[model samples]
Every structure is written in structure tokens, then in C-alpha cells.
Target: MIVAAVPRFRHIVAEVWRPLAALFVWDVAVTIVYYRLPFHAPELPLTLFGTALALFLGFRSNSAYQRWWEGRTLWGAMINASRSLARAARNFLPEPHAHDLKRTIVLRQIAYANALRCQLRRQPVDAQVLRFLSHGEAEPALARTNIANGLVDGTGRRIADAVRAGWLDTIQQTQLESVLVDIANAQGGMERLKNTPLPAQYRFFPTLFTHMFCVLLPIGLVETLGFATPLGSTVAGLMFLAVLRIGDDLVDPFANTVHDVPLSAMCRTIEIDLLQAIGDSAPEPLQPVKGVLW
Candidate 1:
């Protein structure tokens, strides 16, 4: 979701400062203890442990990245499906009411995208969604727990109306419905990703090991590094902690954070595309603010 050329150091520090500071304190305290007591942790054990931790960190980051990539893929499908529907509406629908019906379908498509975005991010329906729906339509759709699904069903109903009214033929209806099905499938995939998460046990162990290793790092290095142990251990701990945080940040791509999937911007894209398709003046595409798209 972050569109910046470079990540802001202040933001990174804010998220990881607590753990980094704790590691610094622990490292310094352990180094002092080693100086006074002549007790130092074995480098062999720490080296072996760090290696194992690195492997686990790699696995964790891969899993989290998969989730992030999958979320992005689903949104890409959504974009394609919306465009397909617009094209179908433009080509298949009979005249007289084609423009009006096409416009309605396009607006509903925009609403569908917004509803999904809001649902994933756990935000209320925004002005964009309200603008697309009538008071009667908006009230009932917003009241539903699954607003996106409800809007999708509404789209189906519109297709049905178009068919019955002879705006769309049976073959044309089938084509449009196929595109709707694709949209629905993408929506369901996104909902599944939102509802589920990486297992707690999978998340718990690596964090525990990362912190434990960080706390003991200075103890392991104090004999060799002497007064430099704190600096060395703290820097190493920061590296480990940074990797762990990256995985954590990517675990939930729909959480409306800077590191999330940028659903707001994506939904805006759908709005712009669908609006322009119906010969309406489309709103400007969303631009990143301070290098963050969402």
C-alpha cells in the first residue's frame, strides 16, 4: 500500500521502537552482568540458534507475502471483472434504455467495489457508495452484514430485470452473468482472506524465539566484544526484529494500514473506469498522499 520511493524512518521507528528499546536495555544489562560475574553464554549455541531462527523467519515472511500477493491478485481480478461487465453492458443491451441501464449497472459496480473495500477495512460506507445508491437502496444494503454480497445480488437482480424487459437477450444475459460470477468469486476469495489469518501458533513461535534470542545476544557476545557487546547485540537484534515486523505487517493485507492492500485506491480505480465507460465525467483517480495509497 505504501507508494513511497523510500520508507519513512520515523514510521518504522514508531512501530518497532518499543521492542528495540527493550532489547537495548536487556543487552546492556546482560553485558554488565557478564563483566561483573565472569559468566558468558556460549557463542556456539547462539550461532546455531540464530541460524535456525533465520530459517524460520524466512518461512514466516514467505507465508505472509503469499497472503499479501493473493489479496492483490483478487483485487486485480475485481478490476478486470468490472471492466468486462461495463463492456458487456455497452455492447449487449438494446437501445432506448441501454444508456440508462448501462449507467445504472456501472454505478452499481462502483458501489460493489466500494462496499467490498469498506467491508474489508471495517470502515463504514463512504460518500462514494452513498452517491451511487438511492436512499432506499443504500439503507437496505448498508443494513446488511455482508454489504458487498448484497450489492452483488442487487446486480444480479438488475441483470434479471434487463433480461425480462428485453434490454438484454438470453445470450447477452449469460455473458454478463458470467462476468458477475467472476466478480463474485473474487469477492468470496477476498472475504475468505479477510476472515481467516495465519495460524496463531505459526505467529507465536517465531516472535518468541526472536525476542528470546535478542535478549540473550549480548550475553553470548560479551566475552569477545567486551564494551562493544551492547552496540553489536542491539544492532543484530534490530535486524532480526525488522524481519519479524515485516512479516507481521504483511500478514493482514486488508487491515487498512499503510502496509495493507490499498483497497481504497483500488476501489477508486473501479469507480473511475466504470464512470468513464458510461460516458460520465469520471472522478480523478486517487493519488498517494505522503507516499501511502491508503
Candidate 2:
């Protein structure tokens, strides 16, 4: 996500340039028609239209922001649960005897975080995943339809095995299992947000009305503004256009865009923490590039 103190002007312009260009052209055309042609510009209730359009865009923007925030919140929960799982495995499992198992569980947790990140963004299992998982483990897990969920299942089985081997008692097993469940719930929430989108009315009507308002803007102001119609109308129309674009930018928080949640950075955080917990050498945390964390 954009982490700059102030985003560059070019970045802001890039988002809405297409609509801005269209509005400017339409405004100029309307001004020319009013001055050169015999067309009488109809008086429109522009103030009322602008008020209602603002409300529509406001509602859509609120909904989109909520989706974006919820995605971030879910990832936060995932991070916490992963740390808890790693700590539990490290402390609860009998040391020296279950040393390899403890390390395996922690590494698998890191792998699960990266796998979930890839799954949410619809990306393939990459080196990040393979780095944590062994060839035997990765082969079977990658064969499954949902690799993240498969990794969770594999971890659960290993935990169950630890309990059977007397490395962890039933109580300790339940505690670790609860942490896994939290991770699974967080994954489910992210998947739901990625799968289901904002309703059609919310997506369609605000955009339609915003463009319609821009079209009527120049025509409505031509008589009053006269030669300044293009300037006045284009500036007024840009406000609504910019607001409309805000909703589009935030609608999908997992779209792998600059506006999206920084899944790669977040995954890196889990990897660093879990590896450090198990006394393994961990990589540095991901840093933002060009002011975007993703």
C-alpha cells in the first residue's frame, strides 16, 4: 500500500487521467456548441444533481474503505496467530527429542503465511513457499486445490502426531490447535473478501451518475459562465470524477495493486518472526519501493 507522506502528483493524475481527459473534451464541445450553434442549453437542476451524486459517491467510498480495512484487519489477525502457533510449538514440544518437529512446525507456519498470500492474490506457489517446505512435504501439499488450507491440514496432523508420541499432552495440543483455527478463520475472511465483491448497484450506478453529471455540467453552466464554461465545468466535474475513482481503487483490497494490502510485506513479517523464534537465521523484513509497500 502507499506509505508516502504525500503521494506524487503524477500518481494522482494517473488514476483519473482517462476520465479527466473525457470531461475536458466534453466540456469544450459543449462550450463550442453553445457559442457557435443555434442550440439553446436547457436549464438543469445541477445543484440538486450534484448533491445527490455526492451522497451516492460518499456511500460507495465508505463501503470500499470498509472492505479495505477489514482485509488489513484480517491480515493482522493472521500475523498474531502465526506468532502464537510458533511460540506454542517451540515451548510446548519436548526439546532435543522433538527438536526437528518443533522447527518443522515453525517453518510450516511461515510457509502457510506465504502460501495464503499467494492464494489471495491468485499467484502461483513460488520460491518463498518452497524455501520453507521440504520437497516431500511441498509436493503433496501443492497437489491440493487450496495449498494454504492443505498446509494447515498438514500442520494439524503433525501436531496430532506429537500428542500421540507424548511430546505434547492433550491440553497443549488443544492450545496449539486453537491457534491454528484462528489462522484458518483469518484465511477464510480474506478468501471471502477476495471472492465476493460489492453489490452491482453500488458498483454500477455511482459511476453512471458521476459521468452523467459531468455531461450535464457544461450544458447547465454555459449560459451563466459564458466563455468560462469549460474551465468552470471541467473543474466541477473533476471533483466528482476523483471521488468516483477512490471507490474503484479500494474495492478489491487483494488486487495486487499499489492500493491493495501489502501481502508480500506482511508475509515477510511472519517469516522473520517465526524463523527468529525457532533460532534460525531470518531474512530482513520487506521494505517499501517507490513509497508502496506491496
lDDT values for all models: 0.87, 0.90
Every model's Cα RMSD, please? 1.4, 1.1
TM-scores of the models, in the order given: 0.96, 0.97
Candidate 1, residue 73: Cα displacement in angstroms equals 0.4
Best by lDDT: 2
Instruction: Give the alpha carbon lDDT tens digit for every residue of 161-183 in model 2.
Output: 99899899999989999998899
List where candidate 2 sits over 4 angstroms from the true fold: none
Lowest-scoring 10 consecutive residues by lDDT in candidate 1?
A: 35-44
Q: Indicate the TM-score of model 1.
A: 0.96
